[model samples]
Target: MKKLKKINFLAFALLVLTTLTSCKVGRFIVYNFADIKDYEKFPARKIETGPTKFHFSTTTKGKVPEELTVKDKKYPFEKYLADHKTVAFMIIQNDTIQYERYWQKYNEASIVPSFSMAKSITSILIGCAIDDKLIKSVNEPITNYIPELKKSGFDKVTIEHVLQMTSGIKFNEGYKNPFGDVATFYYGTNLRKAVSKMTLKVEPGKQFEYVSGNTQLLGMVLAKALKDKTVSSYLEEKIWKPLGMEFDASWSLDRKKDGMEKTFCCVNARARDFAKIGRLYLNKGKWEGKQIVSEDWVTQSTKIDTSNGSAWYYQYQWWLPTKTGDFMAKGILGQYIYVNPKKNLIIVRLGKSKDKVDWPELLANLGQTY
Candidate 1:
């Protein structure tokens, strides 16, 4: 009887292993959850820094608050951040580094995955594409580039529809589900094939439904528009090289060879370099008198507009946490690139997880103190 039981147990274990290995389940089982260091797990294309690096002027006597009140209880600012799984936090104002801190052994050189924050970066590229005339306009039907998706009822979908998150495309945004669309995009090796099979969940240009797939579709459209240039290469030429980034970053791809960038997420970069993205927008798309991206695009991206299926709080992939004209690029697990134009402030916080803090609110309040 004991021998028979052992044989049955072994059989079950083998069956489970086989099941996991044959699908995205195995990837999920191995990866488990997203982490800041997840850049190491995926294939990527490099974004090289420019010859000249722009540095934020730092102050010796930092003016950032040392104590923060959460839930009506006061706690040390560094302790609050450290206890809440924070890895890096930086505050920049007037092109100056006011306060910077790192915890959990993460430092200036550590590479952190951007997660959904890449969505905002993707939006920037879309704007750049328009400036380059590679893309005509946001009003153009996405089918102009991706004619294959026209059969999927994408003809009704405009580039602006996807940009505004009103595309109504069918996508499972939940990353934890192994069988979901996000998991397939994240773990599966073929993004273009998956994108080709995309379908609409509802009529386009009606309601806002934020999904990573919308950004991925934009990536596909951008790819089609570029013709010969990869999106990463365009980024290197347009933004990365011009921004004067301190470190060479990378955009994770779905595969190593003939790979499509996972443009919905996975821009792996350092904290200081990420803050430069905010600086670019803060200066209205100008870098040292050079208009990197159009000022009109910057205004359209950050302005509060609620017309034609646009969300009042979100425009072009940025989150307007309040009606204060501030916007941010947010990611899962507490990663943020917050820009406050009124205060000339930019705050970057990268972390292992959110840890239940009202981050947008905290950043807003912290900005008020400045």
Candidate 2:
């Protein structure tokens, strides 16, 4: 009887665990990418899957640059990996595999979540729509496609404004507590409605505030703009395949069955593919003899714009590292894809997602050395 009761209790516990996790994950789908509205400004598009794995035992550990001497010689870069409880995968230049090491049991095969970093990729696809003339202009109101947002504070927001985090329309965005607006968006049900109903806290385009709502809004715009097509499809055709990514990638969708993609952050890819995006920028949007993203677009999107002259600012979706041309796509925790066009380098580091603030200085140290 004791044995039978123990087995039953264990079964019950496992069932409970599975239920809670599913509910937590499904919260995102219920709110943001729910299937109800129908709008398509651009022609229909679909997602194209990209490469995900290597054929051999390849590691980026070999590409440590010869010039990687840091300000402190006491800090052995090699030893840093063994000491810090973090995960990192690095690629230098577009084609070179260098210095990929992981801790906390993570490696290239780990399909880790991409926090907000996926927004960078989403913005790239938006730019493609603009280039293809599917989008009339960033200046054109997204409302021209999705009219539901017109009466809301979003009426005044432009695609350009949203891309740069300058959209003044209000959404509380820091992740401090479960009661906060941003936190509620993540944890609460009906995330799309909750976000859409959020009142604009400030005037549009006058200030800089980071909000996941901005990216979510961008996804809604993209969904409406690309009629009958998945953003994934468009991205694969334009960015993924053209860049020669090495493995298949996955986008965590809001609703898996209905194909609602998590526009803000849903990408899962290998470190090499992340490096390819960086390399794409390093090469100024050219890949494999094709001009995927325009050099002019890369320049204008990454150039410092509002709020800061030195600490670096965002342009389009890319973060300017300095007044120089170096740019980065950073996500929650320590996810980074750093690109320097002048140096002909692209570096990627994917790690545990909840420890970014604890190690910004350390990350900066690595960034500077690269």
Candidate 3:
């Protein structure tokens, strides 16, 4: 029986390797985990975006070891790490890398799209804009700067309201069959133009309405405040490098003109470097000795506000789960930077999930096991 079990294990391992290498799924490569460094992959930082000439961290510091089993799961997390569509999965606890694994397809150099997760990343950048004195306050009416907004209902909306998804913009959260305003705005017309033309259906900040329209509106505000500089440039100067992130992340554009980077979604990054972002939040926007995010921003941004039966709520584009001592930067279809400061944990899970897959339970369960 022991001999038979060993044979089956070996055969399964071989099958996995063969499938990953042979499977051709769009831009993804499955079987190149061992030789990940050799896959001719896309650049982590696109030069057109003005990133400070790409810096590669040749030596991975505090590298997480491979093959940690997920306790009490139908399928082990290690198997998910090995075969899931995700390019990378990293878990750090006690400020040490506990588990780090890359798929056969992706490596340190390849970039994974953040999708809707980009909104949370933009939230931090907006914090930086405030810290740098480019923006006076989150409460300032957005129309104060953009005269065109004065005639519309958005004139009453503040940056804080936008960030918290409580802007109360009349929007439907439906995405599956996206004939609605938010969907048409995102998937149909030019994003910036679509948002600029939005007519308010309700008062601002009355209730939470998971609308991307507000974030896109805020993106236009960032463009105005940054002196017409590019999103990538401001991010590079303020947030990206200061965080000690080793790779360059790309942002999706609002239009073919490409200068207006979409804030509600579409930022791509490496798995480990994305973990660095979780670590940055873990350390409260500080890297090494200096403070990158003001203590106030981190405190206020993660605070639970507008509760929904104590499940979770949005604050400054960050998600606050009901469990105290835990806040996360989560994106649609399961891109997470789950940080538990109390437990000294930072986790990154990047993937391509065509269908919904529950991961919060996966991490919450880890809290008990580890």
Candidate 4:
């Protein structure tokens, strides 16, 4: 009887250890676990907007091609959507909704997570600050605005470097690693304190590296520069209201109500509303003939940076394809806002899968055939 009791105790201890380990892993991939059913329900802080809403004119003439070629393999677009676990797919052309579809009970009212696409929005906010003359220039050192970062090894880091993602901060962006900086930042309570712990490992602007820490630092700089306003208010006043976003969006904060936004990720809004952002860029920072973001800033923001080499394939917080006049704002788990100015096209895809899709090629095909 004593031997049986001892074996049971050992089994219970093993079970406890396994449970503890799983909890850690759960915290690490907290952002990765969302699916169509629960994606719209993720926790976030409200970024309230004004009453106006941008309405898109619809057309029945446009249709998506049934199939597309990826890596020389003929794949059906329907199958692709199913395989990728896509929740929403939308295409807008000439300022009209050509096609829009929702799956898994997701509809027009659903608030989808933008994930890293928030990086591009944060970049736009930086441009707005520059436009308002609140920020002198992108060339100015980040420490100029956030003086507390003076000793944080950002002596040579500029706002432009951070916007271009070449800040040289030693950060691990691997989403699979439970102990990495990204996981900690996503799950931690205090964003500023978490990012403040980062240290420099290389000279700023030496090479292009994609790290979430750069955007987080930019968020801090914007907060300090604005003084009286929060980033959310600035976004609402400058971009959201100006563009007439249909639904009020929310940006997830690190803490309940007072903490800073996780600017590297987590802007939640309807998929159709996201299309408006694409249209704003498509029109060269002009919405309804009004220059919302400066045309010069738009041109500069999307221009490719070849200082290091052609290998980086990055612009100011935007991803460029081999083709010119086209750019993309991407996020983890298959969120994309692909804009082709020449074609007057904007495609937005939101999904729960992490599978890699050739966005440029897909856009090229759609532009040619659809």
Best-fitting candidate, measured by lDDT? Answer: 1
CA shift at 104, candidate 4, in angstroms? 1.5
The digit string of per-residue lDDT tens for model 2 on 1-370 reads 9999999999998887656435434333333322111112111123344454222234535657443233445456655544544576675643656566667666666555556678889888887788888888888776776677777756777887778777766666656544556555444434456545766666776777777777777887887788987777777888777776666666655433454566666576667677778777776677756788777787777777655211246777777766666778877756778776666666676665433233334444455566
- Prediction-by-prediction clash tally: 0, 23, 5, 0
Model 4 clash tally? 0
RMSD of each: 3.3, 6.5, 11.6, 4.4
Model 4 worst lDDT window (10 residues): 33-42
Off by over 4 Å in 1: 1-23
Model 3 regions more than 4 Å off: 1-74, 80-84, 307-312
Q: List per-prediction Cα lDDT, in the order shown.
A: 0.91, 0.64, 0.65, 0.79
Error of 3 at 319 (Å): 1.2
What is candidate 4's lDDT per residue for 1-370, written digit by digit as tens? Answer: 9999999999998887655434435544544543433324334666766787779998878666678777878888877776767888888888888888888787888888888888889888988898999999988998887766678778689998888887889999887787778876776667777767888888887888899998899899899889989888888898888888888888877666477878888888889888888888988999888988899888877776577422245777887764566887888777888888888889988887656776656765666555
TM-score of candidate 4 on Cα atoms, chains taken together? 0.88
- TM-score of each model, paired residue for residue: 0.93, 0.80, 0.77, 0.88
Tens digit of per-residue lDDT, candidate 1, span 325-346: 8999999989999999999999
